[model samples]
Target chain A: MKEFSLIDTYFRDVSFQRKDVLLGIGDDCAITQIPAGQALATTTDTLVSGVHFLPDADPKAIAQKAIAVNLSDLAAMGAEPAWLSLSLSLPNVDENWLKAFSEGFKELTEYYSIQLIGGDTVQGPLAITITAQGFVAADQALKRSGAKPGDFVYVTGTLGDAGLGLDILQDHTDVDNAEHKAYLLNRLHYPSPRVFAGTSLRRVANACIDISDGLLADIKHILKASQCGACLQLDKLPLSSAMVDSVDQDSAFHYALSSGDDYELLFTVSEEQKSSVDRVLACSNVPATCIGQINGAVGKVDLKFNDESYAYSQTGFEHFNSGESSNKHRNNAKRA
Target chain B: MKEFSLIDTYFRDVSFQRKDVLLGIGDDCAITQIPAGQALATTTDTLVSGVHFLPDADPKAIAQKAIAVNLSDLAAMGAEPAWLSLSLSLPNVDENWLKAFSEGFKELTEYYSIQLIGGDTVQGPLAITITAQGFVAADQALKRSGAKPGDFVYVTGTLGDAGLGLDILQDHTDVDNAEHKAYLLNRLHYPSPRVFAGTSLRRVANACIDISDGLLADIKHILKASQCGACLQLDKLPLSSAMVDSVDQDSAFHYALSSGDDYELLFTVSEEQKSSVDRVLACSNVPATCIGQINGAVGKVDLKFNDESYAYSQTGFEHFNSGESSNKHRNNAKRA
Candidate 1:
């Protein structure tokens, strides 16, 4: 297949179309209009076959994860997803794989009402790089640097389920329940980015980021940027019933604290805005739980369990460590 | 060499700063404000080692080519370069290689006055995916679909030097002149995307595209989109002194007709606007030579040499043919 034919066959007629997209797909550059008083949020993520996903992973799942991860970045900034440019490098053309991938892409793009505007289809190793662009009101963007010392740190949805899901796939842990196994695999393969909650928290949340790096490690981003620290309540960390039932408390907490890829919004709300955040989240039907508090102890993180200090040591996934060590570390968290 | 430190060390302190960039690297997403009345033009390109360039190519050259090619697409759309999001996948971390690569990146971004807003660095087979965004006036942006039957086709600068340069590098062709060899190699390694010529042609040209897939193949994109045909004057093709001096007439023409990566703007100007285009290009000090004319024969291209019909039988690079065939085909017009 020629590059143009490959794009036309699989990506040309995506179901979603947006008014803001002035020109799409075939042009030298895709043209898009940003609404008045809005800023564009741009993010790029690359997924390599062996490094980011197993070689045998489903094309549909890989496609969904690629789009989901970038959209999750936009959601972190309280942006409304608008368009995506995909650069797909394939070792060879496979029609069935392309079809499944396109279907997966269409599903999320339609659900999010975002258009696939432009991209490159190249001949190379199996990898996908997606640059997602979105719009947020000029003054309403959520940034990691906005947290104040008195702010309450909160997270939408449960954490660590995706990590456990990855473990299940790698056979690092076993799930006897067929339904549990399926759910865990789904969690690992398909994550729901907190787009709705993100927009709702735009002006309300003091700071925000999606949990792609684990609760403990990602919160440090907020601390580093805002010049504050956090005290996280171990008992309050939201653990899904699936996770709790599948693993012991220590293992579940470890995954929640150090493992990544949850795609839930981790944000901060001040005392005065807490009620409004709760009300807005409730209206959006997304559960958000306060699990920590920001403090003046810059760059420090304290863990407490039942009002007593808890000692824990583990780090989230870091790329470029020796492949052996990095892979071992990533097998616990698993996506970059 | 963790991901964060790698980014901070190499990409964090890029000198160019744009006032419209509200947030840059280190965030989940980079935020930038699009100027009102301008549509954002976005393009993505991926360069994989051993495919786009030799595996042993200089890191600096590879980096520059990666950014320049994407910018070339923006230029084709007559957009003013603005920002870039880069996704880099590397097999390992080499500080010296990264320093040279970042230096090359810094040179282009600063020269273009564009900002590196965000990107991803991953551990995988070497590949660089850059998504470049620029701005074009909503009504003045050039499109490939606007050529009329009487429009004159023009191309800025020379063609096929890059292809010849590739041949020299691969030892398929030999260049005796030291200066010519250096010039040809430089052309291949450091293509100057016609940014000035492109922006100058915005209101003057009816249709435009950058020559990346050989003039014969790329002009067909305009022909297809405009529902028109073209009669290319083969003898009139602008050949760089380096290209003409290094190869025989037929070989030079073959590369000109079928080789890719010239990064020159190929555009069409109506008869009435031709003088204005000439005047504008002259003011920009960029040589744009008329090489063809658009006609009514939809989707067809006729070649002429000194008013005699010229028969040419070769296609541009197409991905997914057998590796042996495709690689052989690409040797003439590589870079996807």
Candidate 2:
């Protein structure tokens, strides 16, 4: 099929439409009206086959993961996603694959109340690039540089589930229980972006980042940006039942600290705003655990387990780094 | 080097800083304030290594082409370029190549007064996906659907030079004059997007589109969107001296009508607005030629040379179509 017809068949009649969109697809450029008194938050992400995801993964799962990862960036910024521009490069035309991928895109777009404004479909090796834009009120965005020395570190949802899921899929780790395997796989394929939790934390949280590069590496982003250190209580790290049931304590802690692709929000809250943060997260119905405290040591992150200092040495995923053995299973590095 | 350091070394210190940009790199999402009373115009385009440009093409030229093509879409919509999000996938990090690429990017972004907002760099085959956003007054942006039956079709600058350049590069065509060869090669490597001409024709033109897929194919987009037809004066198509000197009349016309990558503006103006359009183009210092007149025949395009019916039978570039032998030299299909 021709590129135009391929797009027309699948992406033309997307279910969600926004009034703010002055012009949608089928144009030289999509025109959108950004709401007054709000700032625009934009991010771009690329998912390469065999690097970000298994080459033979289901089309639906690939589509979902692509959109989810971009939305996760918006969520980390405390922005409500409004528009997405997708550049899809494919090896060849596959009608069934396109149908499933479009269905997956349609589902997430409708659920998020965002519209696919414009994009380009090219002929190349399989890869997907999405640039997501959303609205955040002026001076109200959650940033990594906002943390204070006395702030408490928190995370929404559990960490390392997606990493474990990747391991299970890669056959590096195995789970005998069918339900556990399915749960882990689902977590890997379809991550919740924590949109509500993020927007709720806009005024409450001091600093924020999404954990795509593991808790240890990602929290240091906050420290480096905010110019503060952190003391993480390893025992306090939240582990999903699937993770805890499938792995031993050491493995669970290691994955939780150093593995990537969790898509959970890692943020900080000032001491005075702790109650408010708790209330806001409670209203959003996403469990958030305070696992650490920001300190004055400047970029140093100390780990403590059972009241004694703990030493864990494993770096997060970084593209072009040859040292990480599990880099293939992790989401390739994304700067924004 | 790691991904963060790679981005920091090249992209972080860009010189163009816009006041409307609240936050740029290093954030989960870049924040920008859209000017009041203006709408956002967004478009995305991806260029693969082997398909869009020669795999061994200079890194500087590749970067320039990637940015220019996207800005061409913005210009087609009569939007003033503002921000860009780039997704760059590469096989590996070559510091020298990246330096040249980043320099090319810096030159264009500064020239256009646009800022690089946010993006992702991944480890994959060489490809670039750029999402460009600009601004136009609400309801003032030109569109493909605005042409009337009596409108005069016009095109800016010259066509076919880029195509001839590609043919010469691929050894399919030859030019003996050193200056002409250099000119054609430069045309292929650095086709200028008609930014000034497009913005100037905004209120005067009835409809507009950028000619990337040859004048013949791109004009059909206007025809399809406006529900009208056109009779193109083949003899009136502007051709660069380099193109005319290097090829026969028939070959020049074939390249002008069938080959792609011109990046010139193809637009329509009503009879009453013809003088105004001429004055606008003159002020912008860009030559525009009246090439045709829209007719009521509905999607049927007629070609005329020397006031006689021209029997030209060839199609434009379309991805996944096996019929076109020159598709490899053409820029792959881009919907937006």
Clashing pairs in 2: none
lDDT of 2 by residue, A25-70 (tens): 9989999999889999999999999899988889888988899899
lDDT of 2 by residue, B109-228 (tens): 999899998899999999999999999996889999999988999999888888888877887767888898899899899989888787888889889999998888899999999999
- Evaluate residue A248 in candidate 1 and report its C-alpha lDDT on the 0 to 100 scale: 76
Candidate 1 residues B1-336, lDDT tens each? 889889999998764888989999998899999887899999999999998998889999999999999989998999999999989999999899899999999988999899999999999999999999999987888999999999999999999888888877887666888898899999999999988888989979999999998898899999999999999998999998877776777777888888888999999999999889778887768899999899858999999999999888876656665554312433333211
Cα lDDT, model 2, residue A288: 95
> How well does candidate 2 reproduce the true complex, by DockQ?
0.86
Reference-based TM-score of each model: 0.97, 0.97
Docking class for candidate 1:
high
Local error of candidate 1 at residue A159 (angstroms): 0.7
Q: What TM-score does each prediction get for chain A alone?
A: 0.96, 0.96
